[model samples]
Target: MTDERLIADLHNRWVFGWERNAGDDPFDFRRVFGEFYDFDSPDVRLYDDFDPEQRVATTAAGYGSIWEPGFREMISAHHVVDDGPHVVADLGLAASTLVFVARITLPDATTDIRTTSSLVWRRTPDGWRIVREHNSTKVLPAGALDHRLPARRIT
Candidate 1:
C-alpha cells in the first residue's frame, strides 16, 4: 500500500529467491537473477559481498564466474530493517537502507554477516528499478565464521 511496504516486499522477495535458487545438485542462477536484476542495461551493478580493499564486480561475465559450478551451496536467512524513502532533490530518484542480518551457511561454516545496504531506486515506467546497490559488511575476526557467532557485533 505504502512506498515503504512495497520496497520492503521487493527486497524480501529477492532474498527468498536467492535462498531457494541455488542447490547442491545445480545452481539455478537464472531463476535467482530474474527475480530482481535489470538485465536490459549495462548500468546495473551489484557490489556482492565486497570489501572496499578488494574489487569483485558481479557484472556481465563476472556474474557467471562468481556463481560457477563447484562453488559450495549457501543458505541465506536474513531480516531487513526498512528505513523508508529518501528522495534526491529535483531528481526523479529515491533511496533507502535495508539493514540485513544475514546468517549465511557456507560449505564449511555458517557466519552471521551484518550488512547494511543502500538501495538507490528510481521510479521507472516499468516500475521501481534498483539503479544501484552499495553493500557494507561488518568486520569479523579470523576463524569467527562458525555457527557459534560469539561476540558478534553489528556496526
Candidate 2:
C-alpha cells in the first residue's frame, strides 16, 4: 500500500479506538491505545498542548495514560479528518501530519476541538509503529462543529 494510504489507515484505526470506549466511561484507556505506538523505543515522545511538562512516554500504555483522565467522562464523540494525512517516507521511517476536528460530549457540556498532529513512525518487525507525536489543539466556540460533514460519530 502507498505510504499516504497506510498512514491514513493508521490514523483512522487510532480514532476508532478513541471513540470505541465512549460508552464505557471508566474504560481501560491503556488497552484501547496499546496497538498504536512503539513500546520498545526508549524515547517515544508525546507532546500535547494539555501536557505542559513535556514528558516522554516510553510505552504506548504511558501515552494512553496522559489522555485517560480527559477522556474518562466522554459521553459521545465525532471525529473528522479536516486536512491531509500529508506523508513523507524514507526507507523504514515515515512522518505524517493530520488536522482533525472533534466534537465531544461530557456529562456537563459539549466541546468542539480542532487539532493538528504530526506523528513519526518506524517500520517495526510487527508493523508501522508511532515513535513520536506532537499535537496542538484549540477548543472552538459553541456551535462550531458541523455534523453534516462526513465523520466517525459515536452516540
Candidate 3:
C-alpha cells in the first residue's frame, strides 16, 4: 500500500482502538496505542504538561475531582457524530512522522461536543504508530434543566 494509505489506515485504527478500549478499560494503555509507544516519555505530551502518567494518576484519583471522568469515558466511547475523510497535511519521510487533523463529535450528557484533533504519527518497524494526539473540545449549550430539587442543595 502507498504511504498515504498506510498512514490513513493507521490513524483510523488508532482512533478506533482508543474509543473501544477507553470505554471498557481506561487503564489499558496497550489497547489505546501501539506496543512500541510509551505515553510517559517526554516525546509524548498532552495539553498543559499532562503526560500519560499524569492522566493515569488523575483517573485513579477520582471522578470530577481535578479530573473529569466523563471525558475519559467519552474517549473510550469514541462516538463520532459525523464520519468524514481525514486529510494528510504534511508528511516527513526522513523523520518518519505524519501530521493530520480529524474532526469528530462526541456524545455528552446533555450536549454533543465537537472536537478537532491533531495527531502525529511515526512509522515503526511493526507498522505506523501514533506518537502524539491533541484534542480540543467545543461544548454546546444544554437545552433544558430539571425543575426537580437538587439531590443535595449547596449553601
Candidate 4:
C-alpha cells in the first residue's frame, strides 16, 4: 500500500480504538493493546526500538496512569471538535501521529474545558496499533472570588 494509505489506515484504527475505549463497553487492555502489553508493571513506556517482549509491560504502566477511574470520568463527557485526516506537518511518516482537539462540558458547571491530544501509532501484523498517546487540558478562566466570602467561594 502507498505510504499515505498506510498512514490513513493507522490513524483511523487509532481513533476507532480510542472511541471504543471511551464508550460504555468494558475497557479491555488486552484486546486493544494485543498480548504484548503488560498491565502489572509500574513503568510503561512505548517505543519503536524497545524490546518487543517488554513492550507490554511499559504500555501497561503508561496507560494505567491515564486510564484511571478519575481520568475516564473526566473524559467521558468530552466532545470531539475535530476528527479527520491529520496534516502530518513534521512527523516522518504520514500517520506517525494524530493531533486532535476536543471540548468537555462538565455537568453542572458553566465553564467548558478544552483538551488537545495526540496519538501515535505503529504498524504491526495485526494492523495499525496505537503505540503512544498524550492529552493536555485547558479550562476557561473564571471570575475572581470575593475575599470576604467563605473560602468555598473560590470556584
RMSD of each: 6.1, 3.4, 9.4, 10.1
- Tell me the TM-score of each prediction against the true structure: 0.62, 0.83, 0.50, 0.46
Tell me the lDDT of model 2 at 5: 79
**Compared with the true structure, what per-residue lDDT tens digits does model 2 show for residues 1-155?**
88667877897677557663355657576576667788778878877784656566667778777777767766666677888788888889899888888777776777788889899988888888888888888999876876533333435
Give the alpha carbon lDDT tens digit for every residue of 28-58 in model 4.
Answer: 5456655333343344344321122232325
Q: Over the stretch 32-146, how does candidate 3's per-residue lDDT look in tens digits? A: 4434343334454333112223442212122123234434544323344234335453454212222222222235333324455555555556655445555555553442112
lDDT string, candidate 1, 89-112, tens digits: 224565666565555455555455
- Write down the lDDT that model 2 would get: 0.75
The true-versus-predicted C-alpha distance at residue 114 of model 2, in Å, is: 0.9
- Candidate 4 wrongly placed segments (more than 4 Å): 1-3, 9-57, 71-75, 87-99, 103-111, 141-155
Q: Give the runs in model 1 whose Cα sits over 4 Å from its true position.
A: 20-25, 49-53, 56-72, 75-92, 139-155
Q: Give the TM-score of candidate 1.
A: 0.62
Name the candidate that leads on TM-score.
Answer: 2
- Poorest lDDT segment (10 consecutive residues) of candidate 3: 145-154
Local distance difference test, per candidate? 0.52, 0.75, 0.40, 0.41
Worst 10-residue lDDT window, candidate 4 = 146-155
Highest lDDT model number: 2
TM-score of 2: 0.83
